[model samples]
Target: MLTARFKLDPEDRVVSFHLEGHAGDAVKGENIICAAASAIAQTAIGSLQDIARIEPDYQAEDGLICCRVSYDGDDQDQLIQIASLMGSVRIGCMQLEDSYGSHYITCIDES
Candidate 1:
């Protein structure tokens, strides 16, 4: 199980993220989500410096890519801005889990 940590300020619309495991590889349907997630964080923070790091993990799941992404920024609004484009996003399953005032977006499956 991979995990990500996102530290964000709801009022400021800024973001930073840390990805756990090995995330350098690109799966079939995860590119868009991964790119969108990265873009959102980049846009929210207005720079890539806030992106702490990324790690990837390998698992035995056929036709699916799973990973955790952590980020910090102003609010869900920024996230929603990217999420709203989900329809136009050609990618995998982006799942978000909320805990302890923080949110994590995980890719569950891919094509």
Candidate 2:
């Protein structure tokens, strides 16, 4: 099974996320669920660093990715950009969960 954990701030913004594990529903290279989940998570983080120009604290390894984005209340534009990106990640993961069902994948949000 695959699991994603999202940590949210008081404003319900995604402050951080940890995604790991394989869906194990198929052979490793052929797991569509895993591929979709990984694409969503990686794209969001990549956008943060490359497009948004923010270097979030993060680490990555085989089947594992964990990241945290920092923001300032004074910079609404930056906050909005980051929030939007994070929201996309959350939305993507939830969509996968909805499609694949909890038996293969799980997404949890933490306050």
Candidate 3:
């Protein structure tokens, strides 16, 4: 199984996901990114079933896609839930500072 590493910052709405072991290109990378993002968004949106809009713009570097997630919500718990759900998609290193309004989450694919 292929492994990937991702660093996420929910407050900044940015993530850097690194793919390894044969994962390649923007097309394939998009799937993984979207999957993780969708899981997070799904959790955050909850029963509301609101879809978070993902911007098309992304940066690809050495099989990594630096993507951004944009969503506006009032609850921090919801964001944490989203980050946690992403952990299911990939092993994540998450950092959050409510005082500073900063959330950083990193995920590495473990298959």
- On lDDT, the candidate that comes out on top is 2
* Predicted candidate 2 versus true structure: per-residue lDDT over 1-111, tens digit per residue: 889999999999999989899899999868999889888888888999876778888877878888899876577777788999988988998999999898888999999
Q: How many steric clashes between backbone atoms does each model show?
A: 20, 0, 4
Report the lDDT tens digits of candidate 1 across residue range 1-111.
233443334433213234343233356436443454454433433222233222222222323222222334556654454333231121211332222112324433221
Deviation in Å, model 2, residue 19 alpha carbon: 0.7
**Per-residue alpha-carbon lDDT of model 3 for 27-67, expressed as tens digits?**
65464533454443334334223332333234444433333
Candidate 1 wrongly placed segments (more than 4 Å)? 8-16, 20-30, 47-111
| TM-score on alpha carbons, each prediction | 0.28, 0.93, 0.31
TM-score pick, better of 2 and 3: 2
RMSD of each: 12.4, 1.2, 11.4
**Candidate 2: worst 10 consecutive residues by lDDT?**
70-79
Task: In angstroms, give how far residue 39 of model 3 lies from its true place.
Answer: 12
Cα lDDT over the full model 1: 0.33
